[model samples]
Target chain A: MTEPAAPIVILDKSQMAENIGAVARVMANFGLSELRLVSPRDGWPQERAWATASGADWVLDGVRVFGSVAEAVADLQTVFATTARSRETRQPVRTPREAARILYDDRASGLGVGLLFGGERAGLETSDIALTQGIVTIPIDPRHQSLNLAQAVAINAYEWRTLILDAPPPRFREAEPPAPGQLLLGMYEHLEAELDAGGFFHPPEKRPSMVQNLRVMLGRAGFTEQEVATFRGVITALSKGRGRVLAKLAAAKRQD
Target chain B: MTEPAAPIVILDKSQMAENIGAVARVMANFGLSELRLVSPRDGWPQERAWATASGADWVLDGVRVFGSVAEAVADLQTVFATTARSRETRQPVRTPREAARILYDDRASGLGVGLLFGGERAGLETSDIALTQGIVTIPIDPRHQSLNLAQAVAINAYEWRTLILDAPPPRFREAEPPAPGQLLLGMYEHLEAELDAGGFFHPPEKRPSMVQNLRVMLGRAGFTEQEVATFRGVITALSKGRGRVLAKLAAAKRQD
Candidate 1:
């Protein structure tokens, strides 16, 4: 099954056409698909902005224009307003990753998420800031409160990607990073088989702490499934150099 | 009284000279004194940088050169690392105000504060981030994390000024703002005097709640001592004008 649709990005009362393109460029870099422009200045899909967007023309081509922030985010079950300053109103303040995780998790449960950015000169008004459940504050020099809109998006998108895209659930590609869990299981099997073959558990006295130490070392190494399988193969090949019977025994240690 | 010695700003290996000048402009806007360049690309004091800095050449003139972050911050007791990204390291994360408060308080208590900015593309290295005892993260648009270096410095300097200069201080001034404790005490006296004369705390039964409300209102308003004294004078004058009290109070509140 396909993963959830990409979250919608909404820009409210955006004053700079170049910033719009920059935002599109950052979104495209992160593989985001949709852009919602709310009351853009100098009009939407401006040639200057498109030129600045570099290769992110698809964002301009597919942009949906709305009259207001509320209209732009009406379909979103979750919304994040980005600002340089915090407000008196309290909402759950979270780092971008936590927010991204909440959004990613909710997406699977059939909720749409939207991130809202405001005008370059003034930023989101009080009413606009209040509309979202939380604000994303970027840490910058205290002397300058303004940020280019596109840069703001890239940081958040980076955090989200780190949380969500870094670890895809178990699946086989022709050649891909092995899953961590599968790798652990393979390593455990390999260790147990190698130990059995080497009379590692002969007296049964060496079974407990030796196996535990091996497990701990492997855990510390953080080997992936592919790594574990690769290691297991290496172990089997080494055992085969000693004898075929031992190699067969090592092969039998495959977890699945 | 003349303001304290001008503090120094150190930018470590900043990638863009334009950004350096932009940061210089922002620093100049806030009355910061020095711009120290550490391993900048294209070298410092470039003509383009000066052009971008507008009229902030004083920022460039006071510029100091250093090879590394340690050398730059050695004389300073406190240093703050400004980064948009979070690290696995354990540097205490603080808002720019909080960090600035620490620096300003230290300065007030006799210590120097040095601020560090990293390269434009990669940001401050982990070692650099680790060198500082704390971090200041800017809140911004999550999908686009592209703040120019000068913009980042500007925000930090603004926040530092907010903390070190005065609470509710003027935006542009070379003079020092009143100290925090003095300002707080002044506001309290103003509130008490205003409430005492205006019949605001009248009727013994309503005195406690009325006084409590007065304190809460002023507290919520974040009035600096000077602002509170100004309000107190207005209140006392309005009390003298029996018929015009409402109009005077309305006018005063409107201005705020």
Candidate 2:
């Protein structure tokens, strides 16, 4: 069997450079080196990051900067966002262990997987979470929900590393690699555009939330590349069929 | 089933008050309250500890200070020391998840359990490690094994809290709680005293290591209270029988 890919660690709008460095250290400790920053609060290449990284300079040196969560995860096939609290989104909430299992299973199938972490203060915005398939909530003491950012990453990375070391026989069935994030994003836009034209999203005030709900529902499907193509084809066929019917009705009314 | 008691967290020779405070925060996050410090480099009640604790005052407020590892865990029935590198000790090294399972199982059987952590610089001494039942090793990338002290606590604490939340049915048979640390310590002293008089520890220089080997072998046995009594009784009988034989030989030689 092919070895699973290491998870890409993505931090969104992280507040402190030390935390980024600390996250890099933990990532390197767990054998994960791909560190992507999505609009860090302090601009990239801070000197303090090197001091805090200890000796894991490779992770820091290979850091990638992105304009948004979408661009950061565009090539990934699966993503899980770490959150401290339960959110109103319909995405399945998983423990770090379960998320790690899914990540490994997905990676074993030759898919790219990443873990998205919110900034220290506000956590991932609902929209950023919508881009991911699931939520990973560390089952912490409800009374003291204050977990340090790097510590959160450490726990998730630890789980992934442990799973790798154990290398348990795959209990899950071999699955086709899910479509990359860009394909999924493209599908979401195509469907949302058709839905907007059809007046499917009522009450324009709720459009953002309605769009989020639609994306979340479809994102969790784990659609394959072919499935994404089929879904887009269906969307186009429906749009074309509706236009044809509208033209026929217009002609019929003119004749009457 | 009775809810499992939260594991006590013990830190040995910790240097920084900030790290201690961070440990407290993670401990609180994982629903572990009892914090014991074994001869912290800086004296207890440093204002900086509170500052770094981030309002986890309840854990810091109830912190217990001890002169040594033995004093700190004297009341616990089972203890696992967290170490970064594998040690020369015979104690079985377990992943944090496995250690957490054993801890929950021991706690479910009415045993008081705890996790011991080492200081920042050197980690737990061999003597300190010999006192525990097993070692909890976080499997990380070997090349970059620089896990921060608080992060280690966080991972272990996270495992424990996850087990508690999952609360799976006990898969193993219910066994008697292991003898508390004090009773085991007493037994060790008794055995060592008898062995010392008998010249069982050869080469004089090997005494420390030999004693450590004996302690580690005995410690991993998970002996119950009754078993400890039986073993101590056996030791006393053997010592008395040897004495009786020596006395008879002296009497015989005197008569000749």
Candidate 3:
């Protein structure tokens, strides 16, 4: 699914309309469409939230307001309380990435997960945190330990989107499975024969392991077909140079 | 070092002091200390930025204000241009996560990196984006595609912080590595014997693979020691019940 519906973002007592608008905007950016407000400071459906949202009306249109954090996350199967501060409670703490993974896995299998973020002032109280099973910490600088309201939401939303999307196709997308292992083996064999003739594999006793080591090292490069061809051409040039050297030495001896 | 400093954030022609202040605050949260302001509309070192920053004065104190983006990122090895709109330029695009991984790896190994973000309006000009080797796209909803300046910075900053931070210890710290494989095998064998005595092998044909399949299925659960113990207890209870039934039948036969 292009959009995941489970991550119900519940902002507890958000201070500013600008912050709420920012949260909605970033949520749309990451494909998160659900917005649940728990007693926002400026009240529900503020015009400033709409105006400041730029063009994210879809998120504003789907707002669900609740009286408390418990009511906001009542139907959620997994709830993560997001805060930058340390809590007195013993709930398991996860970094945003780890929490994203657990939520992504749970949501994929038909469970709704919610992330609870605290307001701008000091973050969720001990009472607020008691509502959820786990905490997601941002690991900010210990000296200045505050994140603006939208900043906190944006971080978690970004992690969730990245994890759920998985590794994407590169924009450059010219890669082709790296020429396969068999072709690489043929290149190894061709190069090994050239090496043996050129006396590059010295001290006959160590020859086998040396060739095997070179093959292994080249395999680690995971070369594309073009690179393999270039290497083969280089080997041909080296062998040709050796032949020319021998001819030059014989002619020089005759001249002497 | 606890903090790696390579990603220098360069803001090009920012219109407002508040947006710049918000960027500084988020950067402090993510451990990035460098800020390069390229020709701000309202000029540099505004008190508005200082007031909005809350406590991220360190970033403002160390800012390198310049006349252009080219001058701002001159000494950096890698520069990523962040834009939501598509550019006609042929630069490869990366999601914030992929770009963050590359920057994190490079910065950790001592290479300087920088991210270029455009102003609040239409984002980077074609001429501005053309200067960079790669593009970082936010992948926003196509229907309504507007992201505020600070929100854009927050998303990329969060990704970089996440990539650089190694897996941290959980807050609750009650996790012991899921019960060892040896203990799991012992539990499997114990349960298997109880099932065998109960004649659950069924038709004597699919016994071995059936038992193995059950073990493999349970292994997927990744049970902790408590789960293993509870399962073993369940098996013991079932076996004991069977023994009681046989004893009752023998006693009734004697009475008859």
Candidate 4:
């Protein structure tokens, strides 16, 4: 049996009753029922929607109306804004299926989960995206990324359904994802040790600038701790044969 | 050995060129080579679309242009119009997999096949639907049937290429689909013989109009010669013992 979650849908200023109904139908198709409409243009219980919904009348009838997306997702601990656009955000962006797995696991521990979708025309506003813990973007051709509201919802819902209904074990669990702060700290320590050993920071005047450049290079590399550790191993191996040779050269240069 | 069908894609007044590029990328994703544009709304080979299409520039470069659906399908004998909506027409409605099977079979016999998708918002119009020999509707949720234009094309193209690329066999012999005129002639002869034997044209004056009405009915059945033969076998079995079943039916109706 598939385990159900506290899956709440948050639609922000959506248009098209037929589409909303279609969303309802899709949600029902995937065994999801909780719909939270945020300021829809077409009011609830639309007749045109009923015809288009085919057999998902329960979803339309059970839809929860909300004044704002935040309010719609107020009860949820983890919320993801569904968008195809890459915006300037500090939060993580997860694929729909990945989000579903996290949400499903969280729900087993009694955590409320919510997914927010933009309106029919333009997707969720910047503020709307900002409200979520993370963003969920569908991997599509970058050129034609304008997915309709219902289509976006369907993709997300399909991911959730695949996770819940499929009832299969996960393929692989990767080691814990590294935190940004942990990666940056490791990079800084690595650069400091390499500079000390190389004597590249000998002239105090050039040391700050050289260190800054090294910092920029290391940052650009986005080195994970494991990668930085690999670089450290390479430095250790080279030092075994060439450390004294380089030090003698540096002393001769200073004498000149 | 899988026989490759002549590449054809029919777009109905597509609003976005980027979406066309996206569709092109998806075509390339499944190794489809030909692209056909039908009355594009944003015109052909938009540069932004090409940039978005990433590695699928070849598809855009080789895109064939057409003025209308009929023009696009001019050379295709077995065309499938993809729509989420079910209309009143009696055309065979199939899933993408089923349509792929038919197209692959047709291709083996040297027949041209086209898969048509309509505009982003409304989908295929009735006239566009009429141009197709059958309909291929994706098995989406009964409540929420929301597949975007490129996504729709991608699903069909994916099914098509998968069928061809995965363990293609040489069992089925493909032949050209029979023309409507040929089908009509086959139906006409079969019904004429059955009705003549059953004494359905009792009054000589009513015989001409009766035969015409029967033609109209069989025509509406969209009968191929094979289907007509099956119908003929059904009527022959029903009327074997009765010398004048039509006359007996008329007398029974008069008594009532």
Docking class of 3: incorrect
lDDT ranking from best candidate downward: 2, 3, 4, 1
The Cα local distance difference test for each model comes to 0.62, 0.82, 0.69, 0.66
Error of 3 at B152 (Å): 48
Considering lDDT, which of the candidate structures 2 and 4 is the better prediction for this target? 2
Candidate 2, A106: how far from true, in Å?
A: 30
Candidate 3 per-residue C-alpha lDDT over B1-256 given as tens digits, one digit per residue, 9 for 90 to 100 = 4555648899999999998999999898887879999999999789899888879999988988988765676565457899865444334567998788767755655555789999887577755564454689998988878888888888999998786676232122243323444456667778667666645567678776555544533443334465567446434543443455445544554655
Q: Over the stretch B145-168, how does candidate 4's per-residue lDDT look in tens digits?
A: 788888898899889888877746
List candidate 3 stretches off by more than 4 Å: A1-6, A167-256, B1-256
Per-residue CA lDDT of model 1 for B54-93, tens digit only, reads 9888888778888887667655655678887654433445
Report how far off residue B236 is in candidate 4 (Å). Answer: 29
Candidate 4 RMSD to the correct structure: 33.7
Per-residue CA lDDT of model 2 for A1-256, tens digit only, reads 6557789999999999999989999988898889999999989988899999989999999999999999999999889999965557656678999999989877776678999999999999998888987899999999999899999999999999999999976544243466888998999898777776666666899889877866765575566686678556545543553455445545555655
TM-score of chain A of each: 0.62, 0.92, 0.62, 0.63
Q: Taking the tens digit of each residue's C-alpha lDDT, what string does model 3 give over A1-256?
A: 3434548898998889888999999998887889999998888889889887879999988999988875776566567889755444444578999898767765654456789998888578655565464689998988897688888889999998897678333232232223333455567778777666555556899776555545433443334465567555534543443444455544555655
Q: Predictions ranked by TM-score, top down? A: 2, 4, 3, 1
Q: What are the chain B TM-scores of all models?
A: 0.61, 0.93, 0.63, 0.68
Clashes of each: 44, 0, 0, 1
Give interface RMSD (Å), model 4.
46.1
